[model samples]
Target chain A: MVGVIFKHTLRHSWLQALYWGLGLGLMALLVVLVLPLMDYNKMAELIQNLPPFVRAAVGVGDDLEYAFSTEGMIAVGFFGKLALIFAVYPAVMGMRVIANEEDAGILDVVLTLPVRRWQVVLERFLAYLATLFIIAALVFLGLWAGAQLTGQALDLSKLAVSALNLLPTLTLVLVFTVFAGALFGRRTVALTAVTLFVVGSFALETVGGMAKGSAAEGLRSLSFFAYFDALGVMRSGLAAANVAVLVGAAAALLAAGLWAFQRRDVGV
Target chain B: MVQSDPIIQTENLTKVYTSRRSQTRALDRLNLSVQPGEIFGYLGPNGAGKTTTIRLLLDLIRPTAGRARIFGLDAQAHAVEIHRRVGFLPGELSLWRSLTGLQVIRHIANVRGMRDLRCAHQLAERLQLDLSKRVRDYSSGNRRKLGLVIAMMHEPELLILDEPTNGLDPLMQQEFNQMMREVRAEGRTVFLSSHVLGEVQAICDRVGILREGELRAVERVERLTHVDFRWVEMRFREDVPAAWRERLGDISGVSEVSIDGTTLRVRLQGDFDPLLRAVSGGYIRDLRVKEPTLEEIFLTFYDGDGKRAAQPERVKELA
Candidate 1:
């Protein structure tokens, strides 16, 4: 038989997946469309006029001329800042996978089935990952379509690599949210913890960029944002080490979540 | 014939909840055994640990001490295998609001690897539940019916039902009792927990009464019925003298005596020989006796002077 829990979880998430995918896609398309209207030289001059601290905090890199390139424009606008919107989808879904069901009294019925507790967590996590992947794919398609419509000669390989790289970053956040849910077993607490972590990491990364020292660099390394490397990936190719680190962290979080969930009482 | 092995067994099963400020024991060393092909009623008031025990048996929650076994297999170690042969209906039933009743049933059946849905459809028909309606639109009673259908559809070796008839109408309750009887006829075991005494009394062959986290008594239903008391009212043709009133009060196994003009009301327990003799001397115009409600009988077990309330001969107390 088709895994009943997996099938039901997918059915439960299809509409949500569609909404996030289309919404993120539209946002990416809109950001990319604005790129063709700007004058590269004038935009570079305007960015240079801004305060040094403001420029640093906003992640304006040394290669100002690259900002005019299709890859650069899409990276700075869509992947750097706009991808935060897509992060919310996976975070909320990860928390809902178990904690929300337990709160709503649905998990009591589910756990009584012949399936093991770990199976419940693993299946739901898989379903959530699939949805996140769909959203990311749609965003990539949107970037490609926008480049074609704007008549920009964007590097298709760079665009694909950059888009796929976002998954590991988002996956790390998603698994952390799942870990919080399993540990707390309360939606509000888990949600609050995840939101604080995401926001705090972004703030730390931004401040670390503006600061000048090894201390700041050390703090930045702690944030998942530092390793995202959307711009770097676009300029060069994919970095195997960054992907490995992200995938490894996500795997660790997933294992911890499963262990915690199995040992604790559910629907309490 | 019933199977010799116990279908469900708990050896000193216990559960404790510990917080920073306090610790509460929800179940205290409860040892219970239910035979195959028998309907075992777990009777208790709210918060009497009925749901706790049921959850432990299903392996939904870990026991703080001791363990539970089903079909001679450890509940925690062999949960999947045990669950395969058992169907459970939680006391507070909840479902996916988005799916129709039929879809919910089909999803559970699929999980159990059941290919035939004929039994599910038949159960829905008998319970008068509209499987096409979304679960969000279902009334509380309809939700209960849906739960029953899901639990009974597969005809498992054991059924663990917690407050199965809650929110059900009297007609539906009757149907549920009949369905339970049919389950028993198939040689299946049912572990039913409920606070409603009459329902348990009507259907259960034997019952375990719980109070304050302890199993107070386990006895045959018929034996319990005999221990219940009755209310008696008598009408005299004229105002009786104080001596006659004293005579009625002196009767054995009688209490709560009161007089209103020519009518006297009193509670009668056990034998009636002394009461009949006491009233034979008076010019009795009429007499009426009323059976005590189940609640009254329940209170008799927990009321003041607990030692006097518990009838040693009928109630078998666990150590």
Candidate 2:
């Protein structure tokens, strides 16, 4: 049953994943395209002067004496990409899944299958996890290829840790979408809630970063997007505290989604 | 007659849907049962709670009060097991349209823990389904057939269908009926909800008629046959006088008498003797008798006057 669910979930969403891969890959290629003009030495000095709190808000986790050092650039670049993918991929795909099934009346047919109710919700979630890992691999490879072409080999340790940061936050987004799907009576309502959460986080992150102060820094912590600073990981190769927060939030969100789906009045 | 415990049995199984402004009773406190190997027909009009009842049985939705047991297990607690044993056909057949029909069937088969795909292929052939095509491209009848194939391919012990023959033509309907009879021949049960009266009368051993969120009647096909009523209209050569109208009204087993110039419409209760007696005389020129159908019996129950005629126990349960 698990295998069957995975097959359907993936085959059905292949088109969406394909588009995301192409789009993100092109964005990664831009780093290679612009590497020729970058004055690495001057860029490092500028990064050093940037406020420590602002850098932390954007996931600058490690101390950086020379910002141009391969370590510092890799940390910022690695975690930055991780944070964006976590926000983007799930918001795009997770928005419609549960809500769309219910709206289309397909959920009725799905529920009739011999599988348990919780099993259905969980299996789809597992499929989401599988997709998340696959997409993460694609994003990593794209960046690696771009870095190679530009004559800059990323620190392998930094790349691995960067990918790790994405796993937890991506899971959180998918779970939130599923939970919203179960909570609302209608499909549009579920999608709307997911969109609001994703877009709202990004919007708030922009506000907090652009307008700097104690309150702005405090607010940045609330947005999941602001937590994964790739440059920090490039220098220090991932943070213990951030990983704990991400994993904890992901587990909590998935549990809430499962509980809501189990008890809610469905079959509309 | 041979008797066995019912595969599905409910005593006062009720589902009340409460929203903010209105508490619409979808399924009232209704008692119904389907014996093993019986083709039980659950018939009702629109908004009559047929779908609600089916949903409750599958535990897709919970009931406000009362209990439902399938295979002698609590439906809510043992929903997973019940689902494994029953093949369900939703009245509104919507499915994974992006996938091929074949894939849908295979997925359903796997979920039920059944390995055989031969039944699926055979049923597809019988139903004339093009398994290679995506479900979105299939016509209404084809989509219905797809749902039927997925629901039946696993060969579950019980079949719960909500209007199984919605888009089927007469030939296909006959085929479906034959297929259901075969299911019963193997000592399995087929519990179907339908608005198609002839389909129910032709195959069902027993049927329950629901109205206004209540079940008005539950009886064997043989017993309900006695309640059949037909309407007969007669044309008179001469204008029927007021005295004749009064006499016709006094006749037994006649209801809803009407006269418009040359024609007189009168509803009959049972035997057509009174109708024949009144019109057989020289006053009548031409006559036509319209058969009473299941729709009338159903409408009569909801027509308010049939409240007493309907089972009082079931009626009280609705309130």
Candidate 3:
């Protein structure tokens, strides 16, 4: 079923998948390929002159005070932030792949068939997952190539585990959009779901951080995106709990989408 | 006796479209039935709820009232099951621009769990359609042909075609009628919706005339042929005198009587023999007899000022 969906998508060039790969690929190339070769001493001097707020914002390494080695500069400068944006492209692109079908009146033709509506929804969601894999593979290869070029003591095992780490989490955003797509039957609903998801996540984090018990930490539990502790994945080599959270959320959201798809009247 | 159950049946079906400012009762308490192994003609003017009824049967839109059953199953609850055995051609042909005719058939076949590809090729050949080109580039007739092939390729038990012959040429229409006859011969049901009388009259076994969301008549094509109006034109040695008009007005069978110089053309209501004798009784002159075509019969129902038969209270409220 997933194969049929993937083949159907390729019948038309869903350019969003290509753009998603290139956008994340370019950012990875700039960080892993370029930053590791920059002057570490000069970066250290620049970090000293930078503002205190900017300095303390998101520290990726323990040695942010001095940019000493090529690996250290690359790690602190670009490593953690790249994954956040990488995860986002799949969600946004997934919306287009699913929502555009309804806007194009393709669903009218598709619904005429003997297949159930959820079959269409689930198949398209599986196609989006394939796109995520392709994009993730490109990013992984880029990272491996950069590590080989610099001869740094980069943990290939950790990176391999990290690559596996992104599969379900990235897929969650796509599934979430699919769930919302079923509810509204419009492209804007998918867009609105993505926006509200991002905004609500940050809002939960902010309110959690402001006061009280592990309430903020517990609220962080609500966001699938927040489970991606890059520092843990990068330094310790794996985050199994984070990956489970990603997989669980994705499955639940996709199940909701399938259920809603089966129940809602199409072409409304 | 139960074998007479129609393949498709609608019992007082209704659909209401409510927007912010206004509400349109698209289908209002309508009743109809379509039996198996025949071409059933569904005729109505524009905005007369024909399309809405099709949508409800297909589960594209929900009816506000009443029930519609296809193959003796609930129209909405058993949509997928019903769709599996039925093929539909929507009145508006909107296909994916990028897909070719071959691709369209393949996709529909795939979803329906069908494996017959060669049959689709054969249908395209019969319809005179070039299946290699993209749908966006296909002409109107070719586009309609694509839909026809898709609807027929599955070899389903029922075919629900809306305005099925919109873009076909005269020869193609004859071919289409032949194909419809073949389908009926195979003991399959075809529910065809169209406003053209001759087109429907040529193929349909029975027809339902819908006006203002109400069915005015549902009778066999044989009865329509029997009831078709005929015209009687007689030439007088002189102009029709005032006395002739007074004498002709008394006949119950003559619907309309008109005078053109020495030629007298009369529109017959039903049987022409009664009307013929009445007109030629006293007027000792030359007489010409002609058959009134279907178009003239249609005009009688659709009047100039939106007036129609003063029947069916539901029709009046809808009108």
Candidate 4:
């Protein structure tokens, strides 16, 4: 039954998956190809001369030396900036899993089938996860292809790690949206809550990273974006604790969503 | 003959919708039974708990105070198992508008773990539904046809349909009636809800009347339609005399007697023989006696204080 719902959802959303995947992938490819033509030293120096708040607002957290490196250029320029835009896809898809269907009254028809409510929630989430995987894979392919085309000696493993690092943070955002939809059963409420969470979390992480040793710096731990660490993933490798926290949080939210969905009256 | 177990049964099923400002009791202690191999018509006006009862039976909404059972299994606990053997058409049918009707069928079939779509195609053909068109492109009537096809395609042991013929044309409605009859003939059961009395009178074996969240009556269709009340209209050869009005009113089982110029109208409840004899005494140019329509019979249930028909025994006697 889960496979049935999963397959059905995938069939309906394949075109959307392709659109987001290709659009983001092409953007990554273009950014990689264009970065080699720009003067990294001049760009880094100009940004370093800005006020701390201004640089922090742009997500450059007092790391001017790393920002001049090739890895930092791709991480901060492409992945870090595009992460927020990519988060919206999962947020909207998460709401579509339950809230939109209930609003349109399709959930009534769906619940009449011989599928359990839990299966509906779990399968749709898995379907979204599958799409997220495809998007990440396409992004990696774009970066790898750009590296090859530009003849840049970029480490393929680090580039792959950077793309892989996007999954857990985005998954956390997706499940949070799903949780909101299940608990509220209203699209406007779910979208509004998720928008606040995503935008507020990003703002907190950016501002907190700039104000090191200050009270605001402690608030970074409260944001899902704190675990993203795109530059760290590009410079080093994947961080086990970061991935654990992110994936674990996503699992908790998915379970909460499933519980709420099972108990509520659909299409009420 | 011994009575078989009910295909669908409810025991004091109730539902109350509550919000911050108010609470509306949608269904009030409804105890209903539907037998196998019979077409049970649940008739009611709008907001009469007909849809609420159906939703409870399908486990789309939980009851506030009681339980419903289908095929001897609890509706909520065993919903998935029951759903496998039940086909449903909701009052307001909604579908994924981006997909063609054929795609909807395919998806539903896949969900039910059925590989064959021959039955769905046959049903669509019988309904004159075009399966190639997207749902967004279809008219309301065509959407209804699609809904009917979806409900009947699986050939389940029981069917629960709410307002199944709302947007259908007369021809399509006739087809649906025939299809329901075929299902009953195959020893399956149908529980359909509708406010349209003519269709219920045409096909249902038993009818249940609901009003204001209460089940007012459950009686055989023949028994409900066989009430003695009727309307008698007469056109005399000349203007009705003042004395003739007194004479007609003097007849037993006659009420609401009135004379308008050359026409006389009266409501007769019993013993038409006295009415015929009295009319024969007059110079009658024309006489029309009409048995009250099912609509009129149902109106009797709805008329007066709303609480008047709460007792099923009284409703039976009223019928």
Highest lDDT against the true fold, candidate: 4
For residue A80, model 4's alpha carbon misses the true position, in angstroms, by: 1.6
lDDT of 4 by residue, A1-268 (tens): 5598898888778779888888888998998899889998898889988988778767767777886788888988888887789898899889888889888888888899999988988898888888888888889988988988999999899999999888998889889998998988888988999999999999889878778779999998989988998877888888999999999999988898899888877777
Off by over 4 Å in 2: A38-86, A95-97, A153-157, A210-213, B1-3, B232-255, B259-264, B269-290, B293-295, B299-306, B310-319
On TM-score, the leading prediction is 1
Question: In model 3, what is the error at residue A146, expressed in angstroms?
Answer: 2.9
What is the lDDT of every predicted structure here?
Answer: 0.84, 0.74, 0.71, 0.86
Better of 2 and 3 by DockQ: 2
> Which one is best on DockQ?
4
Sorting all predicted structures by TM-score, with the top scorer first, yields 1, 4, 2, 3
For B200-238, candidate 2 gives per-residue lDDT tens digits of 877888888887778877767655544556788888897
C-alpha RMSD over true interface residues, model 1: 1.2
* Better model by TM-score: candidate 2 vs candidate 4: 4
TM-scores, one per candidate: 0.90, 0.86, 0.76, 0.89
Winner on lDDT between 3 and 4 is 4
Candidate 4 per-residue lDDT over residues B1-319, each given as its tens digit: 1358888989999999999999999999988888889899998889999988988898888899989999999999999999999999988898999999999988888898888889999999999999999999999999988888778788999999999999999999999999999998899999999888778877898899888898877878876666668899999888878776788789888988998999999999888789878777679899899877655776655455444442223423212
Residue B179, candidate 3: C-alpha displacement in angstroms: 1.5
Model 3 DockQ (Cα-based): 0.29
Question: Model 1: how far is A212 from its true place, Å?
Answer: 3.3
Candidate 3 per-residue C-alpha lDDT over A138-257 given as tens digits, one digit per residue, 9 for 90 to 100: 666766777777666766676666665667667877777777777767887777777788667655644443333656758866866567655555555556787877788878877887
Over B1-319, each residue of candidate 1 has an lDDT whose tens digit, in order, gives: 3448888988899999888999889998989988889898998889989999998998878999989999999999999899889988888888999899999998888888898999999999999999999999999999999998888888899999999999999998999999999889899999999988778877888888787677767777776666547998988998755666677777777888888888888899878778888877679899999877755766675554333365545444332
In model 4, what lDDT does residue B266 have? 91
Tens-place lDDT per residue, model 3, B1-319, is 1247778888889888877899888788888877778788888788778888888898877788999999999988898899889988878777778888888788777766778788889999998899889999999899999989988898889998999999999999999999999999999999988888777889998877776776666657655555445787888777776666656777776757787777777766666666667655445487677754554554554454434543222222111
User: Which scores greater on lDDT, model 1 or model 4?
Assistant: 4
Off by over 4 Å in 3: A1-23, A39-93, A96-98, A150-152, A195-224, B1-3, B17-24, B63-65, B210-217, B221-319
